[model samples]
Target chain A: MRRALILSLALIPALLSFAIAYLFQRGAIADFVWSGTYQIDAAGLFSRAGLAGSALIAFILLTFWWAEGRAEDTFQAERNMQEETRRRFFRRLDHELKNPLTIIKLGIANMRHTPEISSQQQASLDRIGQQAGRLQKLVEDMRWLSELEAPRLEQAPVSLAEILADAVALARAAYPDRAIDLAVQQAPWPLADISGDRDMLVVVFRNLLDNALKYSTPGDKVAVRAADDGQWAAVEVADTGIGIPDADQPSVFEELYRGSNVQAIAGSGLGLALAWRIIKLHKGSIRLRSRQGQGTVVTVRLKLPAPRD
Target chain B: MSKPTLLVVDDEADLLAELKPLLERSGFAVATAPDGRRALDSLQHLTPDLIILDVLMPHMDGRELLRRLRKAGNWTPVILLTQVGTPAERAMSLQEGADDYLNKPFDPIELIARIEAVLRRTRRGDAPLSSFRRLRSGQLSIDRQTRQAKLDDDAFSLTARAFAVLEHLMLNPGEIVTRQRLLDEVWGWEHAVETRAVDIRISEIRKALSAYQPGCIETIVGTGYRFIHEVVGHA
Candidate 1:
């Protein structure tokens, strides 16, 4: 509607100029056109009309430009406001879920300590505690996702090799049955260091390794390799597991998005999204390559500090 | 003999109620405080052997209370309790003088085990003479009397638990001290299935020593760390 209004207003100046020229030629300057009466110059009349028409068009164009700018400003402001509101909602939700989850966990712990409970009752309480622990993990992942969306990382000199080692050890501990290997093929004496938040980077690697281990079988091999190429330090986590489908690869980094192959698996689907956000925040990139039946490999690339001359 | 007393400070009334009875069952005279202020006030009259403090609390949190206690020259062992903590938070808490920490919704049995370990260390410290008094390896020297390490003339401070681990390693130089042995000896945790706590402290100690002397503590793959015996002189 506004576009139509602006278009009509733009045409009004040209229309008025044409109408005035027509009236001047027909009524007021009839003799001037036909017999050149009263020494009226025809070229002068056309030039004056042209100048007036240009002025009117310039005024209309300036007004339209200003209005369009205002509309864009309103749009950007609304978008930012909506984003802030969504972020706030997630923060509040995380806090609310965390407190109650803590309470439930404590309650379960208290019940388990009671010696009077039967074995059957104890088993049921164990299940409850396990489920609550899962809920707590989900809540933590959600909170971490929100934090990644708007990161406030306390960056410092962190050893990539150490972080990878810690993550690999943790994954090995968590999934003792799986065959996980860490190959630091080309790490220099102390390994290359990147300026990043150690804890956050650890979380990123842990999430990746956890996903790789979760989707794989007992005999499947998961390999993590780290190397530096002067400008960038890179780590690749590869697994012989169920790979993501071709159609689902693009949307895997989306929040809460699960693949069709992962229906039976229990997951929050926030792992890759969190990893992507964290890597981006550190001025790095993560890439994924996989075949349907083969396996998946995730490579995270981070910039290394320039070597001293 | 009187049982050792423990002060449990948490904002959760239900948790406090539940924990008090459990600790009493484990044979400790337990004192309860809802916040840091009350805990500090209780310290004036009651001298507990150890303090189990919740990190997040109303009106002065555990970290602040610990700083205050350390600032006031109270060297009572403190074990921090939290819902979930990052490595950085754990490191920060250790740096602030907490003897150890446990995650929330922890098994009661585990808490008791940690408490016993910390209490044992505190008791040992109170005794006058121990077998290992002072150790010298190269320029590095550790004095068990003052619980301090000096490299040449510069002194480097370590957390109580880290110091104990270093002392154990220094005493048995060149021996590959297994993670389990360190956990049992330094942490006093007998049935510790998770040895990651030991790994973290070892990592911290390695970081502290990396600047002055690198590779002093050698990590033996699949076993443990061996503190190299590079004795130059005894201070």
Candidate 2:
């Protein structure tokens, strides 16, 4: 739409120049043929000038079309290359972080066994162990996101119910006080598993659950419901909390994009982006319908693969 | 009886100085080694009833020394002493023939208890388990119930916990009783306490045996305590 608008605007100046020149040439021809009397030659010259002007305008329009198409192609190519480079950098970073993390785990284990340490010291050490575990999880998230760009989406029959259950369990453990009302319309939901990376699926649910917990006011219900859409599994995580505004909705899934209303909330702003990538990888679509003061409902439809041979 | 001997091996001079006198006061004939090589050298000439081995050291670490000692068939009960032993590291050590482990900056009382228990365990027997009603393994004699123990026909002096510990080993004979099981059976604790507590008691039992029974208890690494059902002469 923007391209068409620019092309029309550019052609307007050319159209005006042709219209003025055609009028001037016609006035000049009026004197040559007969200033006081009309002649057939004057009319002929006027028609020829009009024909010439239309031919020139058509040629200019064709040139503008070619230039606009080339520019768009170049812009798109640059955007894709930039995305690829960013992914490669993150993947390498994740792999590098994991090596030291493994070593730290082994070293900490060795330290914990030394019986000479006091109990107080041991408790402090355990806390450090938990933090390291969290770091390991973050690195895992990075690796999963980088994998999304690969062409062949690795799909396998995954238990949709089990994944939801696990996510609910984690949320409960994280926020035992929160009243999270989970309603499954189809209790065990066709036992129909969607085909996607189980790890990625777990991450998706976790991200949504995390957001739900954060945005949810105390005593508000965060509902999780799933339905088998025959060809796809549609899961919705609806939170009755502060929601995203209309203008910022389109940019929510953009890398590191945080909604203007929720910028003050603590988050890396990467969760939704990563979730979108996983959804995209499964050849699925995720839609968000949120009202600023009302609530937010994130609906994700994951394309399930055919049954195994 | 003479003082039960303890060989504390660590490269740190300050730690050795502070710990040695404390151990001596606790009724242990304390011996010190600055490094693993020196500790082994000292071992060649004299075998202390208990060895408190440091896990980290220059030239030879506590683990490597324990490995070398086991390879040479030296089954002297060792209490692994270090501040950095993880639970897994301690498990690996126990598996690798380390009789027990204690983290560093250790309490003197706990160290004394561990030493006594390990010593008592080592003096049970050097040979595999066999039924012997009036079993005599060198200075030690087992009079099964009446739960009586004697050293060369003299009544063996042992703490009640020490006696119970010794009895458990004698009954099991060659079998290994894990630290957890020992705590349950002997300490009467329904739940497992720190494995180190068992190590401490074992040290105490070993100390008593060193004075009364000599070499009777044998440590089966990584598994549990066992009685070396034979009278193996000292190195």
TM-score top scorer: 1
Q: Model 2 chain A: which ten-residue window has the lowest total lDDT?
A: A31-40
For residues B114-160, what per-residue lDDT tens digits would candidate 1 score against the true structure? 78867776686732112335678777888876888878789987766
Query: If scored against the real structure, what TM-score would every candidate get?
Result: 0.53, 0.40
lDDT of 2 by residue, A1-309 (tens): 999999999778667656634654556424333322333354454466575664464345446556778988999999789879978987677755743564455456556656699988899889888777666556645554565553423355677887787777777877988877675546554647877655456667778888888986886779899888667788899988888889999988866678888866876667898888878777789989988878899998887677666
lDDT of each residue in A215-254, candidate 1, tens digit only: 8888788999988887898899999999999999998987
Lowest summed lDDT over 10 consecutive residues: which window, candidate 1 chain B? B185-194
Q: What is the C-alpha lDDT of each candidate?
A: 0.74, 0.68
Write down the worst ten-residue block by lDDT for model 1 chain A: A29-38
> Model 2 over residues B19-98: C-alpha lDDT tens digits?
67666766789899988998999998987887888887899988899999989999778888744323345447666777
Is model 2 an incorrect, acceptable, medium or high docking prediction? incorrect
Candidate 1: give the TM-score of chain A: 0.68
